[model samples]
Target: MLETVRRQRRAAALPYPQMTLAVPVAIEGAALHSGKTVRMTLRPADADHGIVFRRIDLEGGRDVTDIRVRHDRVVETTMSTVVGNAAGARVGTIEHLMAALSGLRVDNVLIEIDGDEVPVLDGSAEVFVDRIEATGLTALDAPRRAIRILKPVVVEDGAKRAALLPGDGFSLAFEIDFDNPVIGRQAIEADLYDPCFADDILRARTFGFLKDQEALRAAGLGQGASLENAIVIDGENILNEDGLRYEDEFVRHKLLDAVGDLSLSGLPLLGRYEGVRSGHAMNNRVLCALMADETAWEVVDFVEASRPAYAAEREMLAISAD
Candidate 1:
C-alpha cells in the first residue's frame, strides 16, 4: 500500500509539457467588491504566453492590457489581491480564479474580464474548477517550467508569517487563529499536487467576521459580500444556513489563497509553503522575498525519472508526520 501510494505521488509530481485550455470558457457573475455584473472568458493561449489578464471594458473595448501575474504587478493586497499594468488598468480579487488555474496545472491562459474585479462566484474556486475541467486541458509542445526552492525564504509582518522552503512537490501547511471561540485555532497540511486539491481546497470559501462587515463596506470594500458568497462568523456562531463545509475550513481557505498568491511567480512552484496567520499581503511578500534572492530558488524543467527521488523526500516527511 505504501509503495502504491508512493507511485501515485511520483506520477503526480512528474512534470510534463505545458498546458492550456482546449477551448474557451466563459462565466458571468457579480464582482465581489464592485458588486457589478461582469463577464469573464478563459481563452486558450499559446505556450509561454503565461497567465495574463486583459481588461476589455476599458476605452470602448479598444484597450487591451496584458497584466502579468507577478509581485511587481500587485498594486493592492488590502482586502484582496489586485494586479495592474503601466497603463493603470487593474484587476482585483483574482485569487480564487488563479487558485483554480494553479490547481488544474494550467500553464498558459488569457483571462479577459469585462470589469475591474473577477466575480466572487460562491466565494470559492469550485465553480471555476468545474468550468475549467469541462473545457479540458490541451498539452503544448513546450516543456513546463517550475520554480524550485533551493533555500528557505521567509517573510513576516508582526505576528503574521509566510515561508517557502526546499521541497520535492508542491505542499502547503497553514495555521490560523482568531480570538472568537468559533475559530480560535486551526491547521491543515496537504500535497497540493495531489488530486486532493480539487476536493479538499477548492470548495473552501473565503470567510470574514460579521462584526467587520460595516467597517469593510465603509472602506469601499466587501460591497457584495454576504452569506451567499462568504462564510460569515458572528461571535461563536456561523451565520451560514448550511454551516461549515469543513470544521477547519477557515485554514483551508487560507491555503487556497496562498496557492493563488504564489502562482504569481509565473510558473508552478516546487516547494513547501508554511503560513501562520498570513493573508494576501504576507503571501505576496514571501513571493517577493523569494524572487529578490536569486540564490534561493531556480527554475527547472521537470524530468520524469527525477520524480521518484522527490517522492522519496515526501515519504520521509510523511514518516516524520506519523
Candidate 2:
C-alpha cells in the first residue's frame, strides 16, 4: 500500500516539483549601495524551505540570523526591495537575484550572504542566471504551488498603477515613462515562463540619471555604481561607451524588476500583472491588496504534467486591464 501511494505521487497528473540548486554555488562582488566587497552562496534546501537569506556577518558571525524573502517581511522600498527579520537583520537589493531564481523556477534555496546588500554584478541578472544554470537545479518530491488570481486586484499611487487580474499561468506587462529623452515612454509584455526572460530581460542593466548621482550618493545609495555595473544617463546620451544591450532596455529592466519583486509573493503567481510607471513600492502594494482580499486569489498548482505544456500559456495573453 505504501509503494502504491508513492507511485501515485509520481503520476503524470501531478504538477512540477519544487526545485533548488543541484550544488552549492558562490559569487562575490561589490555591494551596490554600500560599496563593500561581499560574498554570497546559494545552498540547496529541503522541499518546503522557500527562498531565505541568512546574514552571516550579523553579530560578528557568532549567531545565525535569517530573513525570509517574502512580501510581508519587506521593510523598505525606497529605491530597492528590502526584507528584514524580527531582529532587524535585513537584506537589500535582492530583486535581480530573485528574478534569476524565479525565472528559472527554483523554489527552494538558502541564500547565505556576508553583507547587508546583495552584490550588483553588472547591475543585471545575467551573472546570477549564469551561475545558477552552471550549477543546475534539482527537483524535490513536493509539487510546486502558485497564487492564482481569482479576481482583478488593483492599486494606484498618484499616476502609478499596478494590477493583477485573473488569467492562466503567469504573465506581465509593464510600461515606463521617463522625462529623459533617451528613455521616454517604453512598454513590454511577455509570458514570464517564456525564453524571453533569459534571452532578453536578464541582460538589461539597471540605470540612473547622472544628475541624481550626487543626491543618491549623499543619501548613502549607489556608492558602488559605475559604468561597468549600471547605465548612467547624462542628458540625452548614455555615458556607457558600449551602449545598451537592448534599444528599449529601460522598460525591460523594469519588467525584470517586477519579476523579482512579485516573486516575493511567497509562491509563484499564476495571473496577469499590469503596471504603469510602477516601481518596487507599488509592486508590493498590489500584492498586499490581493492578499488582503481573500476572494481575489487562491493557492493552487499552476501546471499539470498530464496537460499540454502550453495550456497555461494559451489564456495568458487574452486577459488585459485598461
Candidate 3:
C-alpha cells in the first residue's frame, strides 16, 4: 500500500514490515451471527501468517479458520460475510473486527474466538480499535506488502454494483439509498491515507428498516441485534433512543463495513474501490474477480526504511510466505 511507501524509515523503509505487539490484548463480548458470548485474546503473529482465527471453545472441534479472504470459501453475503474451509467450519459477520484491525493498520494477528461469531460490540470497530491501539504498534525487519490490482474488475447484481480499479493508494467510494426519509440517499468517498479516517467512520453502527425485523426473526436471524448495537429505523424515523452519531452516519457506517470486508485480502489493498448500493455480496464479488485474474496481482517484498527499531520489529514478524 502507498502508506508503507511513505513510512519514515530509511533503514526500515520497506513496503511491508512484519508487525507485532509489545503485549497481548483480550476482548470479551457477543457475536453478531452465532448470538453467543465470547472472550478473545489477540496475540502478535509473525510476518506472512497474516490473520488467523482459532476456536478454543471446541474441545476437539475444528472451528478455526484463516481470516484471509479467498475465492473458494465465501459462503454467504446476504447480511454478512461468512468464510470457512471445505469442512464447513466458519466465522460470521466479521466486518467489525476486520475494520478494527485494518483501521489500526495491524497486518498480522491470531484471533482466539470462543464462539461462532465475533462479538458485535457496540456495532462498531471503535472498541476493538481502542483496545488494540492501547497495545500499540511495533515494526518488523521486513517491509509491508500490498495487493495492487492491475486491471479493472467489476461485478453487478441488477442495479447494485461494486468495482476495483487501479490506483496508487487505497481508496473507497460508497453510496446507499433508502426511500425512507430518515436515511434517504447518502454517499461517501475516502482515500484511506490518514490514520484518523477510520476513527472518524469506524464507530458508526449498522442499521436496518423496522419492517424487515419480522422476516429476520422468522428466519432465526438478527436475534442479537437491537437498538443498543445498531441504528434501527421504522418507516421514516430512526428508532434508536439515542441520536445518530452524525447526521450522515448511515453512509459512514457503510464505509466502515467496507473497510473490514476489503481486509480479506490479507495484505492491505493498493487500489481504488467503489460501491454503489453495494453490500457483502458485491464486495465479495470484487475480490473473487481479482483472484480469478492471475495477471491482476503479484507478490513483492519491501526494500527500504530508515528506522532501525522498525527493522528490529520486522525481524520479529512470525509468518511464512506459503
Model 2 residue runs over 4 Å out of place are: 1-14, 60-64, 304-322
- The lDDT of each candidate is 0.86, 0.85, 0.74
Worst 10 residues of 1 by lDDT: 1-10
Q: Give per-residue CA lDDT, model 3, range 1-322, as digits (tens).
A: 3233334433243344667654688988876655678888888888677777776765554433444444356788778877776555677878878877876667778888777677888888878877876667667666678777789999989889889887655778999987789988999877665545766788788888778888887887788888877888987778787879989888888888888888887777777889998888888888888878989876555333213543554454422211
lDDT of 2 by residue, 1-322 (tens): 2212223333433456788888999999999899999999999999989999999887744234888899999999998999998877899999999999988888999999999999999999999988887768877888889888899999998899999998766878999989889999999987777645687888789999999999999999999999989999999999999999999999999999999999999899988999999999999999888988999988987562222445443333223211
Best by lDDT: 1
- Cα lDDT tens digits, model 1, 138-173, are 878888888899999988888899999988778899
- Give the C-alpha miss distance for residue 137 in model 3, angstroms: 1.8
TM-score of each: 0.90, 0.90, 0.86
Query: What TM-score does model 3 achieve against the real structure?
Result: 0.86
List CA RMSD, all candidates: 5.2, 6.4, 6.9
Alpha-carbon error at 145 in model 3, in Å? 0.8
